[model samples]
Target: MDDHTALIRATLDHIHQGVCIFNKENRLVGWNQQVANMLSLKLTQFRVGADFDFLFRRLQDELRIQSGTSPASVLAWVEDRGPRPPLRFEVRQRQGRVFDIFAQEMPDRGFVISFTDVTAERRAAAALRAANDLLEARVEARTAEIAVALADAERANASKSRFVAAASHDLLQPLSAAKLYCASLADDTLAPAQTEILSKALNALNSVEDIIGALMDISQLETGNAPVRVGAVDLGRVLRQLGDELHPAARAKGLDLRIRPSHALVQTDASYLRRILQNLIGNAIRYTRTGRVLVGTRTDGDALRIEVWDTGPGIPLAEHENIYKEFHRIDPAANTGNGLGLGLAIVERACALLDHPHGMHTRLGRGTCFHLTVPRAGLPPRDAALPAPEPGTDLAGLIVLLVEADSQTRRALSGLMERWGVEVLDVASGTEAAALLAEIDLVPDAMLIDAPVDDGHAGLALIARLRAQFGQVPCRMLTADCTPGLGADCVLMDVSLLLEPVDPAALAFFLASARVSG
Candidate 1:
């Protein structure tokens, strides 16, 4: 090597910045001895061709974006971007501390860039940045807290949102149970006046559920937890199912429901897709009293464009974008048993999860169209179709033990059982039911235990309790909570569950089905 080359290499080696020399072809030509030291490179075994991906990633994470960007690209632009600052980039290999990265073009043949371990300098800068970030974060958090505190005065409203979001699960648990109990009451056959009182109770329960669920949806979207499960789906089938489910509701509300299917397959989660359509159509039915809800689909290159159109009180053009925001309800006091204004927010979040593009087109008082384009779902899974539950036999001349807490509920439920022509023995508490089980020689054909459960979640301990007592006795939970993650628990315990305040018809059907399966 020439004298200048040797000097450059030696001088660059003593510098404190991570440096490398690259040729015009953007290949690493040479690097100073410091690069090896900082990267934990052993002098005896040095590699000159390795990429700078790690170096840049460390920089990016450290917020040394400018410093990090040059690892792959040449630093020639540093000339115009101002004097290259000694940037604090993290050394991923050692991960000891951040380091300052300094670089300059070579004066001679190729280039000679060296690195000096400036971990201390980096740490110092990072410490400062972290302190600032922490301070900023605290400020943000405090600001939110204040917003919640003064929510009535319009100040704490924002912070109240954050606080509510954090404590939602705890707040919603009891409310969910109460709702289930209310539904159970509604499911009971009573005089018309009594039923009217129960209907009011059901409506109140629904409102609480809507608010809690909406808040949870907002939190999930904001926190990026609502991940999309990409899979192959039949879009036509999804539309049809949505139509079947919502058409009646729409018609009941004097709204038209139309599903225009396109013969396109999607590689996305069918559940998420269905949720999207349901939210859209449900909103249409809620807002448009005498209009139409139309769902249409098309193909655009590699994307599947799904559209939800509604002839409702069309959104004001200026407010279209804002409607996707959290709690952006146009009719705040409609009280139509519709959910918290979380539908659009959830749709927005779902779109993000799917990496889909969503847009809104509205003609005030005319109609509104929401369009989202998603990449097609992949090929169908081999295990797409899970077999339905085996139909069980009729419980002819059989006795059933309705083991549950809540005295009034037990009586109402007993009446339901009596109506089914099955002998029913209702108890005030689960303990009473247990006592009966201990005394009775012939165990009831099946037990419908309104059993209290551990964890205070939606699931029941009844599944395990019954399975332990009488294997395959067909125990199902009559719970009100509608959360996921129950199927696994049911499978593990070999139990079946039906949501609470079970419809007598559906319940009877389930009982006969359980008998057949047994």
Candidate 2:
């Protein structure tokens, strides 16, 4: 029997599962090392005669069963649920190492049990299930947002397209008519009060032009049609030019236009850079009804820096980003020609296109300043000798024939021209001027006609008549409808061209240049 015992121990140790020998009365006659390990420990070491019932009583199952039972009964309970070929569980072992236990009915009488460390596999399965749940949740969230966002974008795009089409037709047509009428009224002889009223009308027309130009620029920028010419830009020169050009406009509104000297040059498209300053300056002048607008520049390491300051109704912190959204007007009924709300959008896009870094600083009710850092457009060596705009009397005794349909515009223009010392024969319209020419014998050296009426800012017929009869006269066309190649068109029509709402100085200089060119 001792030899049989040694043989049974050897066989059980070699077996992969737990082995135990019990009599017909259900007594633990012997157990192998595998059974002891699988069941936590040698129970006989504690109670000398401890049996399976003691360990079974401590077993806990997912079904919440609590009882001491034979291994065969436990196996029957698991298999009863279904055709379970295998049963798995954890056992309370003496060691802390967790093990998965499996039990099966042996061929003869007793049972064979097996156990292993399945902690890694169980954890991995749990992790996979968790990951799957997280992915499903994310997919659901994204699916919800996709529909609403796309619908909003599509609707917005359609509305914008319709607006652009309508503006192209409706606005430009009436604007053309108003310009012609203003030109004709300019020549009408009237009292100072009547003249002032006419001037107001012309001013209104000029405002219309500003609004139209702003809208057009915004639309073109959105459509990706605005021409971008990349070239060297001088920051100082542009700042100074804006300072001089806007100074009078700011002063007219009881504000100051100031510029701080810039030491660095910027490497960017000069035209694009100029447009940025134009928008910024335009914005500053619009909001700053009381205080001052200042354009300043400084050095930013290897980059050139620029800043625009305005002491007006400043922006709130939360609004800084929203203000850059296209066509996002802050004021529902903005009376001032501030913008169509696309000015800053254009500025932002321009900076991105130029690869410049930009930011803004503002305090509510105080003022705001926007700044940008642009790469230096490696400047060229300046010529040793450069001449400034020389002071000269190029307009003394200059003779000009001015034909305009708008009386107020004529008055304003006449004031500007007279200030330049040009002797202007201001007429109400091209027709009246033609009749006046037929009656009088005096021939002016030059004639400038505001080209458009309800028919066109520039009357093609009137220009043809002027060319046919007064071939020697240097005719100039002026209008508020500023477009690319406009000046070239006038050149082709055999006349000098000038933009309307003309600066007294610019008109004077243009005439001087025209005389020289002719």
lDDT of 1 at 518: 51
Error of 1 at 198 (Å): 3.7
lDDT tens digits by residue: candidate 1, 22-47 = 54333465666666666665665445
Query: lDDT (CA) for every model shown?
Result: 0.59, 0.62
- Model 1 misplaced stretches (Cα beyond 4 Å): 1-197, 226-228, 236-248, 251-264, 378-518
Predicted candidate 2 versus true structure: per-residue lDDT over 1-518, tens digit per residue: 99997997788787766655533223356666775655555555433234555545554431132235445767454334333354456543343345566655444444444656554676687799999999889888887788788778667765775566455535654564455455556656889998899878866776765666666556645655444555555556555445544655676678877777564556776646766777888888877768888887776788767889998778876787898898786663643663467778878987776678888998878988988887776754342211122225377677778887766667666766676677888898887888887788566777878766234434656877866786756566765443323432443344444444454444544466445534
lDDT of 1: 0.59
How many steric clashes between backbone atoms does each model show? 22, 28
Clashes of 1: 22
What would the TM-score be for candidate 1 when compared with the true structure? 0.46
Q: What TM-score does each of the candidates earn?
A: 0.46, 0.47
